[model samples]
Target: MGRKQSFTATELLDTTKRLVLEHGYDGFHLKLLSEHLPGARSTIYQYYSNKEEIVAACMKHVIVTVLEQASAVDETDAMSALQQLLLIYVGESQLHQLLGDAYKINTANSPAAANDLEFVEQAHLTLKSQLTRLFERAQQDKKLRNDIPLPVLVGVFFNLINTPNMLNIPTPQWSELLFQMWIGGARS
Candidate 1:
């Protein structure tokens, strides 16, 4: 009989996400990942053949989670939905940075990697569509300013995920604080 696996795929991907966020795609390697995992280095091969495949899968996993949370949001109240979506984005703030390196992945040799990257691209479009819909609805309701273009508003909203949490506040409170700052602005 085959030996049982020591770690789950989720565990591997979780480590991959953290490492990629810390060292970036160029610096991440199987050897580094194995050191952090519970099994031998060869055990990784049973899951993924190459770094490109692993990273691509990791990126797909992150987006899939965000997409699920974003999709569940109630759009009946556009402003409320926007706030909830902002919280989701803040919770996965590292996603944007991780995806920024997607282009660096050479997927030619690995069909699995190519497929995952394709899914990532589609998920991105879906997320964008959802955000655009919410923004447009909020604008129609006059909850947002008419002076600024919708695209600019959306851009700034997305950029909030990158704001440094210097105080190291917990995710939920930090998300709420950021959402408030986004809506209320920096003015006293």
Candidate 2:
């Protein structure tokens, strides 16, 4: 047998994310990944049962970073935390867009879908709760408008943050504008 290829799970996920973004979920294949990396297809299969599992794993990798940034926020400073989280959301917009594209394509329906869906639901709930609490605090402090319900407000912010590609605006400018338009009132 040939010597085993040495690689870390992080390296695999990083390469997977890059490949998925370049090829999209439908165009992405395990063979392509194996060809792109220095490992054998069997090595990849050892870590992930299929391409779908790797895609899900890559998303989870990104979600972990989002949560870590949110966790680093000080409890007393909700607005600041919220801003940081929004920036994080913008930073990951390409990954989010890739996931969106993946969902649209009818490809690679692996058994891992159920687990991935569950994990995504939980992560979304966690992120939503954190956002809702911050908006609630901001509302209480008269920093945000109370006319919009918290859930709707959170949804709007989430939708907006994921729209880096749609907006046609520069990232830094778009982020600042997003914060100002969503969190800070237009008049402010």
Off by over 4 Å in 1: 1-5
Q: Give the TM-score of candidate 1.
A: 0.95
The total number of steric clashes, by the backbone 3 Å criterion, in model 2 comes to 0
Best by TM-score: 1
Model 1 lDDT on a 0 to 1 scale: 0.93
Over the full model, what C-alpha lDDT does candidate 2 score relative to the true structure?
A: 0.76
Model 2: per-residue Cα lDDT over 1-188, one tens digit each:
88777678999998988988898878889899988778578889778887777888787777777778777777587677777777778877774655565454333466575476557658767977888788899889887788988888788887877654566767767877788778656673
Return model 2's CA RMSD, one decimal: 4.0
> How do the predictions measure up, each by TM-score?
0.95, 0.76
* Per-model lDDT: 0.93, 0.76
Off by over 4 Å in 2: 1-5, 101-113, 163-174, 184-188
Worst 10 residues of 2 by lDDT: 99-108
